[model samples]
Target: MTPIEILNKIVQAESNAREIYSEAESLREGFDNYVNKEIEEIRKQYYERADKMIAEAKERETARAEAAIQELDKKLEAELDAAKKHFEREKDAVVLKIFKLAVDADA
Candidate 1:
C-alpha cells in the first residue's frame, strides 16, 4: 500500500475503535448497573487491550497486535462461559432451596 493509504487505514481503524468504544462504554454502564458482573469486568479488560492496540498501531504494525486481539477474544469467551456456569449453579441452588422450604412446610 501507498504511504497515504496506510495512514488512512490507521486513521480509519482509530476512528472505528473510537465509535465502538462509545457503544462499549454504554454497555459497561448498563452491565455495571444491571447484571453479569463477570462479563462487565471482562468487557472492561477488552476495551483496555483494544485501546492499547490502537495506540500500538499508531507506531507501526507490531507483530503482537493481532495476537493480542485474539487473546482478548479468547479470554472474554472463557470468562463468559464461566459466568454462565456460575449462574446455572446459582439458579439450581435457588430452586433446591425453595423445594426444601416447601417440603419442610408440608412436614
Candidate 2:
C-alpha cells in the first residue's frame, strides 16, 4: 500500500475504537443509573418498614405504661378505703378521750 493509504487505515481504526468506547461508556452510565434507582427504592422500603416497627413499639410501650398507672391507682384507692374504715372505728374512742381531757382540765 501507499503511505497515504496506510495512514488512512490507521485513522479509520482509531475512529472505530473511539466510537466503541463511547458506546460502552453510555451503556455503563445507563446501567449505573438503573442500579442507583433500584438501590433508592430498596432504601425507601426499608425506612418505611422501620418507621412502622417504631410506631408499633411506641404503642406497646404506651399501653404498658397505662396499665401500670391503672394498677397503681387501684392500689392507692384500696389504701385510702382501708384508712377510712380504720378512722371510722376509732372515732368514738377519740371523742371519749377528748371529753375526759376537757373534764379533767375543768376540775
Candidate 3:
C-alpha cells in the first residue's frame, strides 16, 4: 500500500477503538447507578423493621410494669383494712373499762 493509504487506515482503526471504549464506559456507569439504588432500598427497609421492633418491645415493658403496680396496690389495701379493724376493737375495750370504773366509785 502507499504511505498515505496506510496512514488513513490507522486513523480509521483508532477512531473505531475510541468509539468502543466510550460505549463500554457508559454501560459501566449505568450498571453502577442501578446497584447503588438497590442498596439504598435495602437499607431503608432494614431501618423500618428495626423501628417497629423497638416500639413493640416498649409496649411489652409498659404492660409488665402496670401489672406489677396493680398487684402492690391490692396488698397495701388489705393491710390498711386489717389495721383499721384492730384499732377500732382496742378503742371500744378502753371505753368500756372507763365506764365500769366510774360506776363502782359512785356505788
Candidate 4:
C-alpha cells in the first residue's frame, strides 16, 4: 500500500478503537449505578431491622423495670404493716403500766 493509504488505515483503526472504548465505559457506568442503588436499598433494610430490634429491646427493659417496681412496692407494704402492728402493741403496754402505777399509788 502507499504511505498515504497506510496512514488512512491507521486513522480508521484508531477511530474504531475509540468508539469501542466509549461504549465499554458507558456500560461500566451503568453497572456501577445499578450496584450503588442496590447497596442503598440494602442499607435501608438494615436500618429498619436495627430500629425494630431496638424498639423490642426497649419494651423488654420497660417491662422488667415495671416488674421490679411492683415487687419492691409489695415488700414495702408488708414492712409498713408490721411496723404499725409493733407500734400499737408498744403503746398499749405503756398505757397499762401507767394505769397500774396510778392505781397503786392511790391505794
RMSD to native for every prediction?
31.8, 2.7, 5.9, 4.8
Name the runs in model 2 displaced over 4 angstroms.
95-107
Full ranking by TM-score:
2, 4, 3, 1
Residue pairs with backbone overlap in model 4: none
Model 1 C-alpha lDDT per residue in residues 1-107, reported as the tens digit of each score: 99999999999999999999999999999977777777788899999999999988865656577778899999999999999999887988889999999999999
- Residue 76, candidate 3: Cα error in Å is 2.3
Expressed as tens digits, the lDDT of each residue in 1-107 for candidate 3 is: 99999999999999999999999999989999989999999999999999999999999999999999999999989999888888797978878888999998899
Best by TM-score: 2
CA lDDT, every prediction?
A: 0.91, 0.99, 0.92, 0.98
Q: Please list the residue runs of candidate 4 whose C-alpha ends up more than 4 Å from where it truly belongs after superposition.
A: 2-5, 94-107
For all predicted structures, in order, the TM-scores are: 0.31, 0.80, 0.68, 0.75
lDDT of 2 by residue, 32-98 (tens): 9999999999999999999999999999999999999999999999999999999899989989999
Poorly placed runs, candidate 1 (over 4 Å): 36-107
Candidate 4 lDDT score at position 92: 86
Choose 1 or 4, whichever is better by TM-score.
4
How large an RMSD does model 2 have? Answer: 2.7
Taking all chains together, the TM-score of candidate 2 against the true structure is 0.80
Candidate 4 per-residue lDDT, tens place, 1-107, comes to 99999999999999999999999999999999999999999999999999999999999999999999999999999999999998797988888999999999999
As a whole number from 0 to 100, the lDDT of residue 29 in candidate 1 is: 93
Candidate 1 lDDT (Cα, whole model)? 0.91
